[model samples]
Target chain A: MAQQPSSDGTAGLRELGEFGLIDRITASVARTENGTVALGPGDDSAVVLAPDGRVVISTDVYVEGRHFRRDWSSAEDIGHRVAAAALADVSAMGAKPTALVVGLACPADTELSWLDGLTKGLADEAITAEAQIAGGDVSRADVVFISVTALGDLAGLPAVTRSGAAPGGVVAIAGTVGNAAAGLAILSRGFRSGKAYIDAHRRPQPPYAEGPRAAEAGALAMCDVSDGLLQDLGHIAAASGVLIDIDGSAFEIEPRMAEIASALGQDPRAWVYGGGDDHALVAAYPDRSHVPEGWRVIGSVWPVPDGGEPAVTIDGEHPEISGGWGHFAG
Target chain B: MAQQPSSDGTAGLRELGEFGLIDRITASVARTENGTVALGPGDDSAVVLAPDGRVVISTDVYVEGRHFRRDWSSAEDIGHRVAAAALADVSAMGAKPTALVVGLACPADTELSWLDGLTKGLADEAITAEAQIAGGDVSRADVVFISVTALGDLAGLPAVTRSGAAPGGVVAIAGTVGNAAAGLAILSRGFRSGKAYIDAHRRPQPPYAEGPRAAEAGALAMCDVSDGLLQDLGHIAAASGVLIDIDGSAFEIEPRMAEIASALGQDPRAWVYGGGDDHALVAAYPDRSHVPEGWRVIGSVWPVPDGGEPAVTIDGEHPEISGGWGHFAG
Candidate 1:
C-alpha cells in the first residue's frame, strides 16, 4: 500500500536488498529475557521452546488495499494490526504466545525506513504478548502483503475449543467490539479528527492476557471477535450445538461513536453488533460467576431441540442492521 | 498468474468467498497416521505436537511472477516447490517436519480448482515428509503469493547448525544440484523437450529423510542447497569461521543435461555447480567414514588463517562460475 513517493533521504529496500534489510532488522530488535525463542533469525529456521508439549499456531494474511491503505495508516500501524490479527487467534485458544514469524512481499522499491517501522511495530506487539519475533522471510512483489504465523503454549492446560459451550452457559465478552468498525467508518468519510476511533482502527489493542484468565476461570468455549460478535458467536453456537441469545440492550455504545454516527447518518448500534477487527475476546462460561473481571456477561445459551439448527439471536429474535456485518474492509 | 480464463465448471474463489475456499481446501486433504497435528483447521488455531520440548520453524514466500508463472508451472507444481523450499529448511535443522501452515494472498477471481491443485500438491509433499497441512489463511490480493511456515520436531536431538563445521571435516551432498536451474534455463528458452530438466524445474524432489540421517551420523554442519551449493556452502564457511574447498572433479553432470546443454549451447557443468532449487542436503562430517549412505563426499574443510576471511574454493583455488548461482528465481 506504500505507493507514495519516497520522503526518506536514505536508500530504500531496493538499494538494501533482502539480506541487508534482514540484517538491519535483526540487529534492531532486542531479545527478551524470556527464553521462548532459542534461536532467532539468521539461521535456516528458528528454534522455539514448546515446553508444554504442544504448540498453538495460526496464520493471517494482510494485503495492501484489502487490509490497509498507506495513506490512511502508518507502516507501524499496519504491522501492529496484521500481527494482532494473527496473535489474537493464539490468545483466543487460551494460550501464551511464544513466537511469531513473518512473511512479507512488497515492491523492491519500498522504503527501508518504512519496512523498518513495520518490523519494529511487529516486535512491539510481540514483546507485549511476551513472545519473540523469531523469524521472517521477504520477497519482491508489485503489491505489498504480509503473512504472520504465531505459535503459543497452553501452559500445560487443554485448549478451550468453540465446541465446548453448553446450554445454560453465560456468554461474555472482554474488550470492545465495533470500535474498529466505527473508526473505519470515520476514516471512510474523509474525516481525521476522531483520534481515538482512528487510532483504534490503526492498531487494535486486543486483551491478550484476558484469554488465559477466562480459560482459568473455567470458560467452556471461546473465540476472538474478528468477524464481529454475532457472526463469531454463531461459530460457537454451530460447533457447540447450542442456541445463543444476546441481549441487544447489553451493548453500550460510546458517546463519541454515537455522536459521530448521528452526524454520519449511521446507526452506532449496528457497528456494535456487526463491526469486525475489534479483536475482543468472547467466551461462554458455566455461569455468571465463572466470568472473569473485565469480561461482562451479555447473553445466555440454550439447548437445540431435535432437528433444530444451532443459531444466534438477539433478544429471542433475529437481529437486523441497516448495514452489512463487516467493517474490516479498511 | 491465474489471470487466464477458467475452464472448470465449478465456481471460482471470487464466487466462493474466503470462508468457502477454506472449507473446500481443508476438506480435500487427508490426515496421516502420525499424531503430529493434535487439532486441524476450524477452531481459532491449530494444535501441533512438539513433544521434543522445542520446535524448528521456517517460512518462505513465493509470489506468482517472482517465484512462479502459471503457464510455466501448474498449480500443483508450484505448491510442491514452495512446500519443499520451507520443509527443507526444517530438515536442515535435523528435525522431522510435523506440520505446516499456509498463508495465501491472491485475486478473488482465482479459480477454485487451481487452488485445489495447489493444496493437493502441498499435501503431497507434507504426506511424503510425514507431516500435515494443519492450517491456512486466504486473502484478496492483486497477484498470487503463497507463504508457508513449516514446524519440525527434533526428536530430542541437538540441531545441526551451519556453525558446526570444523577444520579437516569432509563435505558431502545427499542430492543433486543445478538440475532445477538447468530446467529453468530450458523452460525459459521456450523448450519443453528436456523432460527431465523441465520436470525438475516444475518440482524439486529434495531428499527430506537424509537430514536426520546426516545428523544421526554425526554431521559437523549441515544445510540445504537453497542458494546453490557454492553459495550455501559459503554460509557454512562464514558461520563456522572455516574455509571450504569443493573438488570440481567430484561433480558428475548427468548426460541428459549435457546433451540438452549442447543443443542449447550452454554449459551443463555450470548448472551442476551453480544452479539451485535441487533442495540437496550438504553437510560437513568429521571424516568420509562418518558420511551417511546416499550422501557423497564432494569437498573438504580447512581453517581460516589469522586476519583472513572465511571463503570457498574449487580444487584448492577460487573458481569462477559462468552466469549466476540462482535457479530458484523461477
Candidate 2:
C-alpha cells in the first residue's frame, strides 16, 4: 500500500497518548489573537463570535484512497484542500469564515509528523480566509480520514442562494475552474510536470473574499464549482427554475493546461466543463455591468420553457457526457 | 467482511448515489420548526441563529471497532451515543446546542439501512437536545466512521471553563457515572443481562440542561466525566490550580451495576473511579447552597501548595491503581 505515515513509523499516536496528540495539534494557535474566539481548544467547547447573529456551517469529509492518495499527495496538501472544499461552501453562501472544528480518524500507527503537516495545512488555509482553528477531535481507526466543519458569518447581508437567479442574469466565475481536475488527470497518468495544475489540486486557493463581494454587488445566485462547471451550474438552474446556456467559445485554455492536454490526447475544454474540485466561485448577476472585477463573464441565464426541466447547455445544446470524475480513479 | 447494506446484500451507497443517500438522510427534518435555522440542508451550507453573539462549538470522531462494533452496537445506538458525546461537550461549556453538521466516511458497500439508522440516531439525539441537523458530508472509505460538530448558543452568558475552580469548592455530579464502563465490562464477558447498564452505555442521557443551570448557580468549573472520576477530576485539578479529594463514602453503586460487577468478581468501585463514558456532568461549586438541586456532592477541592503538583485523591490517600480503562479493550 506504500503507506508511510512516518519514516521508520515507530512513534505512533498511541505512544503519544490522546491529550498529548491533541496538545501538539493545537498548541501553536494564539487563541487570544483570533478576534472571534471567546474560548478556544482545551476547553469542553470553543466559543466563537457570531456578531452577525447567524452562522453558516458546512462539513466535508476526505477519505484516503477516495479523495486522495498518500503516494500522490502530502498530508498538508490534503488538509489544505479539504478545508478549502468546506470553506468554499460557506463562501458560496456569501459568508466570511469564522472558525473550523476538525475531526481526524486514523490508525494508531499514524505518524506524528503527518498529523502535524495536516494541522499546518488546515491552519494555513483557515488563516488565508481569516478564520481560526477553534477546536478538533482525534480517534483511532484503520483508515486515515479528516472531517472539517467550517463556520462563517453573514455580516448582516442576505445570503445569495442558488434559487435567486433570473432569466436575464449573467453567469460568471471568480477563480480558476477545472485546473484541479486537469491536475488530477496529469497525476493519474504518472506524470508530474504540470506543477501549476497539480498545486491547484493539492491546495485550492479559493477566492474567499469574492463571496461577500458578490453578495454586496447584488448577485442573484452563487455556488462553488466543485462538481464541474456544467453539473454545478445545472444545480443552479434547477434551484432557480431557469435554463443556463454556457458559451463554449468563451473559455481559452491557458498554455500550461493546453500543452499537457495535447500530450495526453485530451481536449482541455472537456476538463473545463466537466472537471471539478478547483473550488471556483460561480455566480449569477444582473448583467455584465454589475459583475465584480475579479469575475469573468462565462454564460447567460434563460427562462425554462413551460413544464420543461431546468438544464445547463453549451451554446443551446447539451454537452457530451464525458463520464469522467478524476477523483474516483482510486 | 460482514458488510450487509441491504437484506439482499446489495444496494450499497455507490448504487444509491450521493444525492439520493443525502436526500433520504435529511428528508424528514422539519427545518422550519427548529426556530434557529436561517437556512437548512439542500444548500451549500446551513445558516443557524446565534442570537447570543457567540457560538459554542466542538467536534468528536468515532470509528468502527474503536468506538463501536456493529455486532455489539446498533447503527442507531452508535449514532445516538456519538451525538451524545459531542453534545455533552457543548453542555460542558454551559451552552445549549443549536445545530450539528455531521460527516460520514464508509465503504461504498455500506448498507442503506445502516446509514439510515445512523441518520435517525443522530437526528433523534439532536432533536432531544433541541438542536437540528444543519448539514452533512459523506465520503467512501474502507472503514466506517462518523464525525460530528456541534454548535451551541451561550445566551449572553460568560462561558464556564476548566480554569475557574477554587479551593474549598464543592465537587458534585449530575446524572449517573460508571454505568457505561460497567456495561462495557459485562458485554466483554459475553453477558447481555444488564439491559439498563448496556442501554446507558449505548445512549448516555447527560443532564444537558443542568450545565446551564450550574452556570447560573455560579459553579466554578465543570467537565463531563469522560475518563473516569479520578482521571477527569485530575484534569480539573491541573487546570484550576487546585487539588481534588473524592469522598469515597459518598458514592453509592446502583443495584443494576453492582449486581453485574458482583457476578463478574469485579469491584464496582473500580468501575466507578476508573471508568469513563457515562457523560455525567461533574462540576465545582463554592458551597452546598450554590450546588444545583439535580447535582449531588461527591468531593471537595483544596489548594495546591506552591511547587506542588495538582492531583486527585480519595480521602487524602492515593487510590489503588486498577490499571483498568474499559474502552481500550477494543
* Highest lDDT scorer: 1
Per-residue CA lDDT of model 2 for A20-47, tens digit only, reads: 6777777645531468777878888998
Relative to the true interface, what fraction of contacts does candidate 2 keep? 0.68
* Best candidate (score: TM-score): 1
Give per-candidate clash totals: 0, 1
TM-score of each: 0.95, 0.94
Interface RMSD per candidate (angstroms): 4.9, 4.8
Report the CAPRI category for model 1: medium
Top candidate by DockQ: 1
Q: Candidate 1: where are CA atoms >4 Å away? A: A1-9, A305-307, A322-330, B1-9, B31-33, B322-330
Per residue, candidate 2 scores C-alpha lDDT tens digits across B112-158 of 77887788888888888888888887767777878989888888778
**Candidate 1 residue lDDT tens string, A94-131:** 99888999998888667777887788788888888888
**Residue pairs in clash, model 1:** none
State the DockQ of every prediction.
0.53, 0.52
